[model samples]
Target: MKNSKFAWLLSLLLVVALFLAACGGKEEGTKTTTETDKETTPEEEEAAVVDEEQVLNLIMTAEIPTMDSALATDAVGFDLLNNVNEGLYRLNQENVAVPAIAEGEPKVSEDGLVYTFTLRDANWSDGSPVTANDFEFAWKRAMNPDTGSEYGPYMMSGVIKNATEISEGKVEYTELGVKAIDEKTLEVTLEKPIPYFLSLMSFGTFLPQKEEFVTSQGENYAKNSEAVLYNGPFSLTAWDGTGLSWKLVKNDQYWDKDTVKLTEINYDVVKETATRVNLYTNGEKDRTSLDGEYAMQYAADPELLKELETSVFYFKYNQERTGEKTPLANVNIREAISKAFNKQDLVDVVLANGSVPANYLVPKEFSFDENASDFRDVNGDMATFNVEEAQAAWEKGKAELGVTELSIEILGGDTDLSKKMDEYFKSQLETNLPGLTVTLKEVPFNVRLDLDTNQDYEIQVAGWGPDFQDPYTFMNLWLTGGGNNQMSYSNPEYDKLVNSANNELALDPAARWQAMADAEKMLIDQDFGIGPIYQRGLMFLQKPYVKGIVAHPFGGDYSYKWTYIEGKN
Candidate 1:
């Protein structure tokens, strides 16, 4: 009985020893598998450390009016077009005109009247080769009178050879001096030597459009994202004509797509200041413009950015609307309104975005003379605020119009900030200029643009940013019967001065500069065709991780070609 018990105990001990050995082997095998699974390759390790989605979300104060380059007249449309289409040149970080589609510098004629450009091998978004014919077609299409392109007639009329004649229906569009020498070469002849012609190439009015694509779309050309063909670093997407939101995706077919970093960019039009601020604070928006109280609140924020742009806002006095004369037609009345408003108060109290009161048509520190002196410094202030002067002018204007009281409507934007500013103008004008009843017409940005185009408003609050790095952009708007002269402002002296600046004075740098300065003075100080309000100053919040956003003083307001998302997961 003792031997039997001893054998049973030995058998139990052997079984226990086998179980412990099996458990130990299983644990060792599991650890070996885990270590192998954790092993990372070089590429995998780099990706793990640098994993970030290359997406950007931004805000726009107004919706884009149109995507068609030739038809776009506002900053929103132009800015969007700048990203989705490549011109012969594009403005760089320093506001310098850099070669975009053109290869290096152009071969210029001795008289500087001709420019021969050699295009680099490029492709449209459809993978078709971009030829010089595309440029010729786009340019001529703009100049076609039937196209009724505002910017086409305004930008090209005086610069390109036969542009004015073509726009005036005096000559065929083919007569305008732009030709495709070959598949990769283009020749452009100018009416005269334009000092800022190279910079003008970067303007939205000069972007290329594919002939086949544009023709195929017919009435729907450039009406939406799918209707347009992109040739730049980004392709516009998700825009449905008048939608409030849009997206820009990297164009794989772009010539320099390898250098593009951002995969996608999203844009939402948030007109309300509170909504824009909330979007920025909640990390929903990467950037937002701050105005009024928001501008003051974020004055000390680390992410706050301020830029004094070369844009000028003003009151456009319409002499006639729908074939009937308005009270603003009287020079004294225009001058009274011009000098009545307190521009300093408007900038300090309402804007508070570092904006400065502009007493002249051209903003300071923008255009430089041959001696590098600012145009504003040389010309000094004109038609500035003077309550007494304004009252006296108002009385004289009333007598001239044979009226005891006069009522006028002022058209402005429908945004919260615009409404506030317009109210301030109404109060100031009524308080300062007696017997003046002001009515405010608030409309969307696009509606305001249309009204201005149709000469359908009495007095409109308008603004102009430089299309190129020249004072002509601002000065030429008041030219007699100019395309942008929707106000019926006509002055022979102004036309003569501007024409001389671009023609007889083309070769004489000093004379051209002085002529432009003189024209600006006449328009503001003498004619009072437009009342200078303030120079634009932008204050916005930007994420620290959002990098390489190029803000330009001229052309498009911003460029996202070099922009990218970094240090954000």
Candidate 2:
């Protein structure tokens, strides 16, 4: 089977710097403004000059949860992880797979099941050699049931030999497919051939972990800047685990440190749009994301840039609540909720960006068939809005639940945009559906993620970005008992289709594509398990001098390795 050419399609993609999660901590105190070249005015535009300190000051909407690749779930963690860690391959400037820690491309078996990779001698930030044994330990740890890595079971299972059994605790971790043949060599055996395997290697979950460092820290691993070792272009600094400010400094010991031009990357979590804009205007920040009316106001600004991201934001319903089945478990109720909300109004009015309303899970232009037809187009929109139909479904669901009135809470982020949208959904759902009350529960990103993982919410607003270039990256999340399936909504037929597409029909391109299409239809149309919202478009305000930062559609969003300050001597 051949890999899809769509792997690098997101190279042209840019997005607003929306952190994938919420942070609860208080915002750091604003940096005191320094004297600027007052001879220039706002009209001059050039007044916002580069800091010239060789530092990239930026704003993050959320604080990073952890640096440990195995446990990090959201884009914020992966964004820092992608820069501070190295895997066998990394996404290049073109968004295509490129060699990183590996000496070169891996050797494949004639059967297409085995991969042998030779490692390049590299050192961790602490000057310790990165050995193939490090990778073997990391892979096994991820697969171990005790590790509790969401990505390990979701991605590796059904792909790597015995990975499913190991994750399910049915087999020893030693039975997992990866092996360290020598200090400089690694061999991996997959259950079957996966065309996007190389791209998957670029994800942080596949990055190596030093056994000695990992065991020594145990629960403290990756808790703060000093807790973990860096084996990539930068090392994190000044992060006290819960603080709102952190820095990424160039790793002088990195194998390719000579090529890293940016010596420091400073980050501060700024939740308010006005604050971010003020910082950028005052030359305290190099970039800031725009939303709501800000996006509309800056629409004509020369510095304004709109990014079409291949990500989907949706509402995932938790079916199994403690003591009783949630109202979401009722198919009619789920369908009603899906239709009651107005997606068009949400994006046009609240977001006010170039984002598109989505009636399905996967975003448009995310993947394509060998014939060049879009996967989303082939699947068609599974959920659509119709007030009359929604009312009818609501009535039917009320009768089924034997209730005259019902109320539920919606869990969401604490960011300004998140709160605004949360209120909108609350109003719409409550107003549109009679005899229903919707409450908003907004928490910091980490808290929301914890609630989601525990399945403690009735309904939650969630988003997903592809980890690799394939429909399966999104499809695999809902597989019967998959790790990312926090909703606990399951359909046997859907599982069958996904399993068959992944394993049995993997080599049959046409059949595999059909199977995925069928599975998605079942998940959305038949089950109504989750409600589709929209595809995000980030409005970016970037300094023209900021150069070489790679905008990726999936896995971490941006890469800082090749990023440099332009017009600098």
Please provide, for model 1 over 270-335, each residue's C-alpha lDDT reduced to its tens digit, 9 standing for 90 to 100: 889999999999999999988899999988887877777767889999999899998999999999
Candidate 1 stretches with Cα past 4 Å from truth are 1-50
Question: Worst 10-residue stretch by lDDT in candidate 1?
Answer: 19-28
Per-model C-alpha lDDT, please?
A: 0.78, 0.77
Which residue pairs show collisions in model 2?
16-538, 22-445, 23-445
Candidate 2: which stretches are off by over 4 Å? 1-52
Which 10 consecutive positions of candidate 2 have the poorest summed lDDT? 16-25
Looking at model 1, how many pairs of residues clash?
0
Tens-digit lDDT track of model 2 for 466-552: 665567666767877765678888998998987776666766777887888898888788788889898777787877667667777
